[model samples]
Target chain A: EDQVTQSPEALRLQEGESSSLNCSYTVSGLRGLFWYRQDPGKGPEFLFTLYSAGEEKEKERLKATLTKKESFLHITAPKPEDSATYLCAVQAVSRGYNKLIFGAGTRLAVHP
Target chain B: GAGVSQSPSNKVTEKGKDVELRCDPISGHTALYWYRQSLGQGLEFLIYFQGNSAPDKSGLPSDRFSAERTGGSVSTLTIQRTQQEDSAVYLCASSFGMQETQYFGPGTRLLVL
Candidate 1:
């Protein structure tokens, strides 16, 4: 079975603190690794998609990196508004179609 | 809709009642998905639909939960004999296809009291 696990279930960071959230996976074939940010009542908003190992992408304060077995979402000098549950999902394209298997997610709270 | 839209932003129902949640996908999207998010479980995949083809219901929790998509657009997820365990925010998302980026809606919060 394909699985995704995110670490540090919850994270607390003071303003300007930098940290990284990990998402380890065991997938047959990786088509893409997706990152999303979700608020309390809203659905997840797309963050970044990494298609291969050693690939990195960034937007604002969030940067996503992928390895063969895992992915990391690095936050650079985060602010309170960056607080939310960050989700990690992987698409097992080897199985055909883009069926994404998602992890429970990492809740981040950045306090000022 | 400019984005995926879910109906009844908030719903409170007594246990044993049946409820229907609606999802209207973005225009021209061929793939749609439903997921549940709870305080403890986070987000879980429920079901997925692609075009007018048969849906992939593999992720549905039980027979008590069923969903149907009509005309390859709007979808309705029906829960029978809802239990307190069913309380969660049900989210809907859509993409151009299975491989495209998915855009999500403001979820429908269902509280089974």
Candidate 2:
């Protein structure tokens, strides 16, 4: 069975604080790992796609790193605007079609 | 220039009634997907349509849930004999190809009374 688990279900950080969220998964064959940010009442917005271990991607104050069994989303000097639910998902190579298995997500609050 | 779009930002219906939600993918995107999100829950895959190929409905929770894509551009999700537990946000997304990055719409908030 393919499953994704995100730790630290909720996090409260002050502005300018740095933190990291974790996403662990068990899949038959790793194809792609995705990160998304979803605000209230809106669909998730794409953030990054990590395809292999040791790969990393960054955007402004956000950086995502991948490993064989997990991924990490590191936030640097996060702003209040960065507060949202961060979702992690995985696509398995064995699935053939583009089906994504998603984690429960981590809610982040960056207060000023 | 436009992204994926879904109709009826919010819908309220009584239990046992049926409802249809619509989605319009990007101009040339060939892969369209439907998902359900309950309060504080992650996105649950419902169905996927790619070009002229058959849709994959394996993720659909029940037989009462059905979807269709016409002309490979627009899609609709219909829920029959709705129940209160069916209330959730129905989200639509599209990608250029099977493994490409997906773009999502604002989503339709369905409320069953």
Against the true structure, what is each candidate's TM-score? Answer: 0.95, 0.98
Give the per-residue lDDT of model 1 (tens digit) for A10-106: 9999999999999999988888899999888788999998999999999999999999999999999999999999999988866556467889999
lDDT of 1 at B99: 88
Error of model 2, residue A52, in angstroms? 0.3
Give residue B86's error in model 2 in angstroms. Answer: 0.6
Candidate 2 regions exceeding 4 Å error are none
Question: Cα deviation in Å at residue B81, candidate 1?
Answer: 1.7
Instruction: Output the number of the DockQ-best candidate.
Output: 2
Which of the numbered candidates is closest to the native, going by highest TM-score? Answer: 2
Per-residue error for A27 in candidate 1, Å, reads: 1.0
- Top candidate (lDDT): 2
Residue pairs in steric clash, candidate 2? none
Chain A TM-score of candidate 2 vs. true chain A: 0.98
Evaluate all candidate structures by whole-model CA lDDT and list the values in order: 0.91, 0.93
**Candidate 1, residue B86: lDDT:** 94
